[model samples]
Target: MKLTTCFSTVRTRMVSSQPKYELIQEVGRGSYGVVYEAVVKRTRARVAVKKIRCHSPENVELALREFWALSSIQSQHPNVIHLEECILQRDHLAQRMNHGSSSPLYLELVETSLKGEISFDPCCAYYLWFVTDFCDGGDMNAYLLSRKPSRKTNTSFMLQLGSALAFLHRNQIIHRDLKPDNILISQACTPAGSCEPTLKVADFGLSKVCSTSGLNPEEPASVNKCFLSTACGTDFYMAPEVWEGHYTAKADIFALGVIIWAMVERITFVDVETQKELLGSYVQQGSEIVPLGEALLENPKMELLIPARKKSMNSHMKQLIREMLSANPQERPDAFELELRLVRIACRELDWDT
Candidate 1:
């Protein structure tokens, strides 16, 4: 069967004119919506359903924007969370029935099955639903927190993250929110079902699409000239330009740098007091300008310094990371360059270790 046909069959099985899918339990919650683990009546497919509460115009707009954005670029890459279908609230059913209709559904339907049996009438009317593949491993934030050391991020994980970011940037989409909480792991691992996880970038609620016309290929500047005046990201991951209301794709790059720092150093951005101190030192002491790489390396015992026992990272990796984290947006490497650099490091790491 064709891929589209398979997806269509899955959608029909998951959603109907009546409410057939049973909400097994709550999976996640956010300011915008509550996610539930639901199962389809016909096909018995298990899925994650995100239902956003539309309290205001802004909330509705955010929901619509996210839906459209995901729809527009669905399944562009394996590293991105795929959108199977979007469920718009059925007003007809809402007005006629006392029970509420599903509104603004973002579904990730996984192919896994639980042992429970669900009984539903074939003739009963059901509300419309969105279907998507369910990722059983859960979000990166939960995974990282579950680790024994709490902050021990491995090298392979970082490489996978970099690859996901590269895919997002290639599509001219900037995931404004690139925190650990937004990355999700797939259920499929290794043969023993225990391997380093593969990550997918989720939550496009804060993402912005770059205009192709004004984008400068040579310069690192994006064509998205519309000043994103509204500050919408987490405080710690917010780039300096983001606070200044002059964000571009570079802002996402900045966040990626913070993520890399977190994975390597096993520290939160807010917890890095020494980074703030060093930047402040540059302002106060009137000292000769110090390179960020040198500054970070100098303070080996500093709480915020990225832990590098022997500075094991190769020169290329260091240089790439430095460029990504550059304070000046103009100096930062674009997404393509960042991807190439990361791929090289990942490949080299594998070669050297072998």
Candidate 2:
């Protein structure tokens, strides 16, 4: 049986007994899955393999969302994570679940997502494997904090992120969760021996694609108009509207603002879950650091003290960030405009050499 998703038709079947990729080492692990550093046995090209066990509805939903979002995007962007392919394994049989294809096992996953819990034989376990590019540098938080602060790195990252967000928005995708940890870095070195890295926005489990249909047939539907009510995102990176249980793509702008602000000032906080210091912006209230979203929700009119840590900051950049993090989503600029502003700021105001 074949299943048609909102994006495309599913077609997949069982593959040969030969293993395509050989696992090398464990790279990372989370609640849903474990990531491995692997390589293709035939070509010996390095790739990151994510093994996700679909044991529950929540896990199935998250896996499908990531698969749908990445597979739906026909043209890949430089700063966005590239999904090479997906393989589904059940018992001793393995099937290649390529984009726009599905099998009985794949359909079973879709049913599990829509119909909640399903019965799986005790001996049979379903696992989905996602193979993608292997980021050598590491996550954004570790990469930036490992080295001394540089305006060149900051400017480059800002431009790259802006471009990425703009591309996603253009494709009508809203990344509900945007944080430093979700952003990966691919290491690179310039001819002048400067540390330059390309940013890849990963983890699309919370991403949503806005519908193209609009109230008016003549007017094109804008991602900004597609409001989402579910309050989902990292606490420190959520926008005020998101905290209130309603927001649009503009929430992404606010999250990006928090990241760029913390990155520029080198502000960090310890993550309660991992007990790791992560770079992110938050509001200080009575000695305790509070989420910026919650603080704004309590007092919408409250003014933020821009450059709270830095003694002096660029006037234009400060203003732009303030607008991006504004309490009102309407006040925040969309991703398209943000990309233009970032480019102008990098070229005119910021000194690349410094």
Candidate 3:
């Protein structure tokens, strides 16, 4: 079982000498650093603090990038991580003597990470860190692995995820990594037993801001010119062009498609070995994906997903997934279009007003 719950009762463990916040315990770890739960001394508001040991120049740059990525999108959308502030708390006297400086990030507290990465331990944790809102629902990956969600719950999650991604794409931000691990769930208690699960897209470490100023002045200065050339992100969801070093927002759409497919079908398409094989193929043969529909053929796990697709998929949702995972990035619908499509499907499937 994932580590979650028990954080509220833990005694305060100060990660830094900063008097304003008190640490509760370690909660989760992101792509680059460790995360902890903290309390604001004045208001006693709980928050998640991320700690990074800045030992080198590259580490320093990564810390800044993560800070700015979350900070830049602050208050921009309800579904993004809220960065409270950043701080530089000196490490231990011994460690500080050797390292020379401190680096910690502060953020608003949510319930839990989408992956349920919190376990209330009584022991206090002391580490240099940053803070952000805590997410209660853990992460999408854990939730799906635990159990298949109710149709109603799935609708709510898809709506929030699509809306959040739409908001980001509109702001010209590419969330290079949109896996289940990065999508958090916020469950609100409502009269209907609970308000729909609200998903917060976190871990912007791989995200990039699209800009077009570097191109030749003679050419058009379109923001779309800001193409990413890195072949990053988890394999199962990677788009074809990502391997070729030329991709855009549509690349994210491809990832979203894979995510939604796994979400509804309750299956993990490619295994770790397959991921390595495909990555090797791309590195050696310059080919990323096999072909459309080849996903079911290539991954044995698709046996379950194939049946689920036939039984549960309606025309609209199926069409959307297929289009999003198309071989041609241009053929994929942008986030806005995907959101609209999901909204319509949700309204029809859930019989709720749009």
Number of colliding residue pairs in each model: 13, 5, 31
Off by over 4 Å in 2: 1-12, 99-102, 119-123, 189-195, 214-220, 352-354
Order by TM-score, highest first? 2, 3, 1
Best by lDDT: 2
Candidate 3 residue-wise lDDT, 1-354, digit = tens = 111221222223333333556778877765467887777767887777777755433344455556656655535677777776554332232111112123222220111112233222223232224567877777787666676557776787788889988888766678888888788777667886855567889877677766536546554333244688877776656777776678787888877877777677665534455341111111111544332223532442332222233465676776787777776777788788889989999877563211
TM-score of 3: 0.71
Tens digits of per-residue lDDT, candidate 1, 49-125, equal 67654444445556545665576664567677887665544232221111122322212001000112212222333
Candidate number with greatest TM-score: 2
Global CA lDDT computed for model 1: 0.55
> With candidate 3 superimposed using the best TM-score fit, by how many Å does residue 342's alpha carbon deviate from the native?
1.3
lDDT of 2 by residue, 50-85 (tens): 989888888988998899888888898989999988
TM-score of 1: 0.68
